[model samples]
Target: MSLLSTVRNPHDLKKLTAEDLPALAAEIRDFLIHAVARTGGHLGPNLGAVELTLAIHRVFDSPHDRILWDTGHQSYVHKILTGRADDFVNLRQRGGLSGYPSQAESPHDIIENSHASTALSYADGLARAYALRGESRSVVAVVGDGALTGGMCWEAMNNIAAADRPVIIIVNDNGRSYAPTIGGLADHLASLRLAPEYEQVLDVVKQVLGRTPLVGPPLYDALHGIKRGIKDVIQPQGMFEDLGLKYVGPVDGHDVHALETALRRARDFGGPVIVHCVTRKGFGYPAAEQDDADCFHAVGVIDPSTGKPTAAGGGTSWTSVFADEIVQIGHERPDVVTLTAAMLQPVGLKKFASTFPDRVFDVGIAEQHAVTSAAGLALGGIKPVVCVYATFLNRAFDQVLMDVALHRLPVTFVLDRAGVTGEDGPSHNGMWDMSFLQLVPGLSLAAPRDATTLRAQLREAVAITDGPSVVRFSKGKINADIPAIDRVGTVDVIYRSPEVTPTREVLLVAVGAMAATCLQVAERVASHGIGITVVDPRWVKPLDPVLVDLARAHSLVVTVEDNGRVGGVGSTLAQLLRDADVDVPLRDFGIPQTFLDQGKRDQVMADIGLSAQELARRIVELAASRAPALTTGEAEEETPAGQR
Candidate 1:
């Protein structure tokens, strides 16, 4: 039987011989390459960590000896050995295994921090706690070299080194992040990756000297002392040693036996040691290795052989639309500089980066830093356009409030994935951008219903020199190819069927991505002899005065959005109507106050009652209630007229 099929847990893996370990690593890599290609998870990171993971399982007694994976996306191999191999088929699917580490999933997984630069802090806390309680078990933190760029990681490093505790930090340096890591730290890591051959020669010299006789032993010790002195002068990684942490390696991370030996030494030798393991991302997969941009960082269902995407369709996605528009705008305006939180390709800013290399900055997965940096860019008299995922922007709320909004900086924030981003699940959903950004003072937030409006609004956001403005666009294709009107404060009026006469009955105002669904509901309702007024309130925040005025004319008003019901655009509009004392009955349709599961976008939406059929039924029920109220009011008026 193959090593992968035979081994169910780490305990089983520990039983394998040193000769068999390479075959085991090979088996694990093949399984990961096949499984991830079919299910589509974090392929490159997992592929890179196979031998390292094997070495970890062999060296550390996990579930007892705490091995914390930083930014948990790379924990797939860890999961497989911890008795989750059978569950790999349904990886990242609804009700199956999560893409990141979850404490609920296993006892071995102590932290579920999918966000980068958080695992070290967790390791520090656990180590400190263990030290106080007099626990003997070791605490190992596996952090990527890319994650070192984050300020939080350094904060943890400082603390861990100062505490002088038994915390082993395995710096998995594969020289890539979601994209290739940016900043000074990434350059330092590149130097370390190149030093592994020299590191091996030093190890061989040390081993030979240790085996020598009495006089030879003293001479070897002197040579070792000199080597340490020479290392301090010449090594680039001396930064870690200066911080009170012992440094070992530039070790071969792909060689299972070498990694096992280094880890063993680090385990025995105490007080915060960083074993810098050098490995190749997309190591076994030739196609991924050939990929210069992130080595197929996060794949979506692809053929294992060619690494081409399996599913195919033709429609310009919101990301592509944004990329095309931004590139055109950058060409037109010299001051329009772009910024990203380590996402160039995902947010579709690759061409912009290529065109304006100096102007476009990929600020490593540090959202807060990106925002404040944009504020600084604005202060320097440049029009800074900051692009980031909506979920990630939540990390920089304080920066947006204090640095940008308080100063009234003209930073244009282009929020990508502004609605329910399916498949990635709760942590990745962009549903809360409107709800949270609405609370920010002096911030103007708008959403685009179609591609044309998305392009036009993005331009307007950059061109305007007022307070911070944001243009949020959803995932997937635009509803239609209609061009946006240049007017700033106007909302689009769609779904006005000329066949039916207009009535002051029900008005359906939809927000952003939900506009297309609302129009479908309007068409369905019209077929039932009820013509509903379907309007797209493109801009969510600064709740359009025209929407309120139109709602006052209608007897029943319903607001639809793909965000949380509480404090979202729908609730905001409802509050506005109530404050105006319009006396019109209102209903808000949106996502519920609970965490969503990962699944197909349309299927998930339907299950949550956001479909056209569901919304139409609810609207029909609300319309029917008006019959009793109308009858009672008319009868009372007639009686008063008779008495008069």
Candidate 2:
């Protein structure tokens, strides 16, 4: 029988001896490799975290003592140790196990939001709360080296160092987040990094010291003091100690016995301590280790042997389209530059960086800094395109509004994954960008309908020299070309129901990826002799003057967008029509203003009533509910727009 089956919870793990831990760590690594390959989750990070998590569970009594994960993608091992190993089959599936740490899943699991550099603050607050209550509870936070790139980590660190309480911070330094970590912190950490041989030699010294009769503890303490002197020879920058936090070793993270000893020292310190554990991202798995792109940071249905993705993906992705188009744009405009928040490859900026290495800047995981830095670049007469996921853009909204938009800088923020991104759960969904970016005055936001529009809109967004512009697109496969019949100002008249004259009953305003769904809805409604006009308003913000007339021409206006309903394109258009004094009743269709759970894109969209069938049925009912006789802005009905 396997060791994992015997240990269902942390209490069971506590029963294992020191010798059993290495075997258990090996088993966990194998388990993660196989399980994550099948279920498709964070493979590399969790693989590296096996021994660290095992040591933590063995040292700290969880549920009573809190253990927090910085960006909870590495919590798969924690979940397995916390009696969730059986749920691996349903990982990231609908109503199944979440990809990150879920408080609802178990009391042992806390801090559900997977945003980086946040756990230190949570740990600080939690530790202070426990200290205030006079309750003795060990609070530990395992933060990735990648998360340290963010400014919030330092802000939290400053506060944490001041507080007089036991809060152990494990800096899991695998040295990459999607790609290798940038900035000085990573380099400083690398200087103090010790080899595995040195750690084993230290362990041997510890064993030899323990065998001594009475001077064992004192000799160990004397040696620990000298270790700092030895470290100063290698790297004098004691970054953690300077912050008023007790600093522990740059210990070999893969060594379970070494990690346990370090953790034990941190647990009993009665104050904030930093345990720097150095390990490889893909420690045991050769495929993941060989993956220089991200060390297989995340995978999707991969073969365990070769670490190749098995899922059949269709044509060109929206990312690839942007990737190719941006490179072309880079060639055309030397003034244009690109920036990413440590996601050089994922956001499809690798080629641009390769082509123009001098221009592209990887600003680490700091989105706020990335926005402001792009502003500085724009201020210096450079047109900077800050590319990031729509969800991460949430972190730098204030910076975008003030630093970029307020100054009227020519910064184009190309937000990939701008709509519902499934499988990564609520935190990863890119459904809020359109709503908030709408609030930024003078900022033009474009929502592309297809690969063709994405390239076109991206070009248009970069050409603007006065104010900040945004060209946001969805995740995954690019939509098929939605050929336009006519261009009404900025709007593209994509579809107009055939054989239905004069009286247009409904106007379907499809934004970005919603064009295909709106077509399906329009077709179903049109089969009943109702003339429905579907237009893709490529640029949503600063509503075109043509849309006001389009709304005036139709009896009912329906706006569809792959964004949150609140203050989205639908609501913005409704407000615009009301401001224009047109009373065309609008039925706005978009995602519900709520946190969506983990599921496939189609499943989540259907559940939120954004499905074609659901929208079509609703539109059909709305047509029947309209006034018996419909009138446009004039008594004479306008001619139906078909292929015009």
Measured by lDDT, the strongest candidate is 2
Query: Roughly what TM-score does model 2 have, to 2 decimal places?
Result: 0.93
What lDDT score belongs to each candidate, Candidate 1 first? 0.82, 0.87
Which runs of model 2 end up more than 4 angstroms from their true locations?
194-229, 501-504, 627-644
Residue-level lDDT tens digits of model 2 in 144-233:
849999999999999999888898999999989888999898888877684334445556667877787687677878877666655456
Residue-level error in angstroms, candidate 2, position 623: 0.8
Candidate with top TM-score is 2
TM-scores for every candidate against the unseen true structure: 0.92, 0.93
- Over 332-446, each residue of candidate 1 has an lDDT whose tens digit, in order, gives 9999999998888889899999999989998897889999999999999999999999988989999999999999999999988877777777778787888888888888888
Instruction: List residue ranges in candidate 1 displaced over 4 A.
Output: 196-201, 204-225, 482-489, 497-504, 626-644
Q: Which pairs clash in the backbone of model 1?
A: none
* RMSD over all Cα atoms, model 1: 5.9
- Ten consecutive residues with minimal summed lDDT in candidate 2? 635-644
**lDDT (Cα) of model 2:** 0.87
